[model samples]
Structures are given as C-alpha cells and as structure tokens.
Target: MSAQESCLSLIKYFLFVFNLFFFVLGSLIFCFGIWILIDKTSFVSFVGLSFLPLQIWSKVLAVSGILTMGLALLGCVGALKELRCLLSLYFGMLLLLFATQITLGILISTQRVRVERSVQDIVKKTIQNYHADPEDTVAEESWDYVQFQLRCCGWHSPQDWFQVLILRGNESEAHRVPCSCYNSSSANDSAVFDKMIFPQLSRLSPLARPGPSTDLCVVSAKSHIYREGCAQSLQKWLHNNLISIVGVCLGISLFELGFMTLSIFLCRNLDYVYDRLARYR
Candidate 1:
C-alpha cells in the first residue's frame, strides 16, 4: 500500500476511537445533568428556578452533552464511510461548535467580575426571602445547602444575616446565624427556632411560604458559624475552578483542530490513493 493509503487508513481508525471517547464523555456529562436535576436527596434539587446560573447548569450540561455526542457520532461515521460529503458536513458542525465554545469562553472571561457580582446579587435576593415565608421550605433548604456545600454564610458576610428579619426583632442582640452555617446536621434541630422567624418576616418580604421542619434534634456544641461569606467563597471557588474549566475547553479545542486537520489530509489523499490503486490494476 502507498504511504497515502496507509495514512488514510490510520486516520480513519484514529478518528473512530477518539470520537468514541468523546461520545462517552458526553454521555457521562449528560447523565450527570439528569441526575442532579431529578435528585431528591441532594441540595442541588432544591435550588429554585430563580437561582440565577444554578438552575441553568443541568439544562446546559444536558444540551451541550447531547450536541457533543452528536458531533462525535457524525465524525465517526464520516471517517468510517470515507464519504467526502459526510466528512464535509462533519467539519461544518465541528466548526460551528468550536466557534460557539470560543465565543462563550470569551464572554465568560471578559465578564468574569460582572458574572460573580451578578451571582452574589441573586444570592442576596435569596437571602431576603430566607425565612420570609413559613411555607418556603425549599428556599430555606436550598440556602442551607449552599452554606453547607460552599462552607460559607450570608451573602456578603456572616453579619449580613443581621439585615434579615431573623435578627431584627426587639431583642436586637446575640450574633446568631441560620444553624446551617455552623453545621448542616443541626438544621432540623434549629427549625423550630426558625419557624418562629417566618411569622416575623411574613409582613416584610412578599414571597410564598414552606413546609414545617419535623424530627427535632438537640443542638450539639459547635464552635462558630462559617466565618467567610458565601459570596467570597463562591468567588474563590470560581477562580480555582476556572483553571480546570479553561483547561478542558482548551484541550477540546485542540482536539477539534487536530481532527479537522486529519480530516482534510484524509480527504485530499483519498483520490491520490485511488489513482495509485488504478495504476497497479
């Protein structure tokens, strides 16, 4: 076999395998999105649709994963069939996806600070409704989960809760936070105390209400509420994670570029290989 034929054969096999891996990765991400969306035991499930970017996560993951898998399958079929038209279509779709990824990356990078601030604003709004309604158990559970997972309290600082009605009664003293800040396990134990707060806030925030917390347990001796603000913790977490996130995007972009290059070479050589075989015949 000519070198061109050998190279074409190699490229075909390589694309098939690489795209298979891509499809699998896409599947994992898609399944994860579905799991988080429907998960009853997890804090993520309680995050309301009004939660700014949080609510978008599952849908975004599912949609993007499906698109990636589709692209991978197209590339695999194009390569295996050695059909120039299919290959061209595959290239176009990959190009479109690459452009989208680049555009999103640029937007997120340019708007980093604004994005963080926007998320905090949403959290502040959430805090305003924290205990505002006796029936808002989901919102309460969601905030508690945020503090537990992010290991931070309040929107700006632990003291920010002071602005909430929970701290603004005639007592006007004693620095306390939603029990979740100290420890999540004690959340139910602190609910009876929190239920009392909702009635006080009812007149203030114009939000709906929630279910009652049962199975009261005794509070254990814990040191303190989380000293850091969730906003800052969230900012730091985003900063740290941004590295891996960028790395993955960069890696996928490079893969797409490589695949496109391989595809072009494979297409160009097809005719040459066929011509060589005709001469041998």
Candidate 2:
C-alpha cells in the first residue's frame, strides 16, 4: 500500500475504535436518563419530591436530561455511519441540547429571585400579624430592620430570607398552625414565645454574630428558644440541596460536550477516508 493508503487505513481503524467508545458512552447516558424518568428508586425521584412545592424545577431538569440523552444517541449512530442526512440531524439535536440547558438555567435563576422576594413578603406579613395593630410603630421598626438586614445579606428581592423561615415553621408545626394565627401575633401570643419563635429565626440566620443575634431577637421574640445545634442542621440541609442541583447541571453539560466532540472527530475521519478512496479510483 502507498503511504497515503496506509494513512487512510490507520485513520479508519482509529475511527472504528472511537466510534465504539462513543456508542457505549451515548448508550449509557441515554439509558440512565430513561431510568431517571421512570425509576422511583432513583435519587432524582427521591430528592425531587422532598422539595414538595419546589418539585417543578426538578421535573424540568429530569425532562431536559432525557431529551439530551436521546439526541446524543442518535448523533453517535449518525457519526459512525457517515450519512450526510444523519449528520444534519445530529447537529440539530446538538442545538436542541444547548437550548434546553439555556432555558433551564434561566428558569433556575428566575426562580431564585422569586424565592427571595417571597421570603421578604412573608417576613413583613408575619410581623404585621404579630403587632396589636398592623400599623403599630414597634412593628414597623422591627419589619424595617429585618428587611434591611436581609437585603444587606445579599438578598436583592423585595422578599428575602423569610421563605426559609416560613418553611422551617411549617415543618415544625407539621402544618397544624391554625390558618388565622399562622402569620399573626395571635399565634405568637397563644404559643410559648420561646417554642414558636426562636427556632425559626435561628434557622434563618445561623451565621449572625452577637449584634445580629440581638437583631434577630427584636425581629422574632421567640428567637432564643432553640438549641444551638438546630442552626447547624438547617444550614447543612440547605447546603446539600444546593450542591445536588449544581452537580446535576454540571454532569449534563459535560456529557453533551463529550458527545459533540466525538461526533466531530468521527465525521472528519470519514471525510478523510472518502477522499483517499477517490484518489485510488
């Protein structure tokens, strides 16, 4: 065989090896995605439902992964066959994958903003409900201080850390807090101040120092009731949830990147082979 022919043969062998690897990777990703969609035992299924009202976000992510994996498998097959039509389809699939990620990213960012705003609103309403009169000067001062400190702590929305506080309360009360007293001072008055207030406030801002702790007390009269340990538990729970979501997004990005790179390499190899064959003819 001529030098050119030898090179072409080598290229074909390399392409075959790369294609095999790509097929395996694509298949694994596609199957795993399907499993995530249907398998109740999957981590995505469990963690997703744990968020209850926030499960919508997790469902979006799972659907995105399924679509990406399906496209990736099709691309791998098209690259191996060197069919121009399949190649075009593969590119379209890649575009879809890119678009899905962009959409999910935007949604997540917007939801984060919404959550922050809702938090602030809850705090203001809670304080209002606690005062003898919603327009009381003491209540107004307390609400302003709480809102200001929350904004200072990097919460940019009209609402702030109040969502987390409310969630903590709901969990503790087991949803038993009466609707009338749920966001009001009557609930605070009826329950022991220490039991009802301190636990929620401590969970909201465990990182606060002495002055901030005093501020927390002003904002929530029952602030001192919780044991110091509850703060760490709440912090750890939040950290773990955030980490899991980040990890899922990163993994999907990496898988799409690898599939596209491999597809390009295979197409170039096929082109090189076709050119060499024409020369020999």
Name the best candidate (by lDDT): 1
Per-prediction TM-score to the true structure, in the order listed: 0.67, 0.38
What is residue 117's positional error in candidate 2, in angstroms?
3.9
Compared with the true structure, all predictions reach lDDT values of 0.68, 0.46
Misplaced by over 4 Å in model 1 are 31-61, 131-144, 166-176, 184-223, 238-243, 273-281
lDDT of 1: 0.68
Model 2 CA lDDT for position 262:
52
lDDT, candidate 2, 1-281, per-residue tens = 66755654454355446545655665566555555445423442344221121223335555655554555456545655566566566666766776799787888677977865676566546443533342333433444333332222112322222343432354454211111112234334534334434443342343534331122222232332122222233345567788887888888677666655555655555666688779889
Per-residue error (Å), model 1, residue 107: 2.5
Query: Candidate 2 has which clashing residue pairs, if any?
Result: 116-159, 117-159, 119-163, 120-159, 120-160, 129-185, 130-185, 198-222, 198-223
lDDT of 1 at 190: 45
Q: Candidate 1 lDDT, tens digit per residue, 117-189?
A: 8877877777777666644445565676677678888887777676666545456455456655664344535
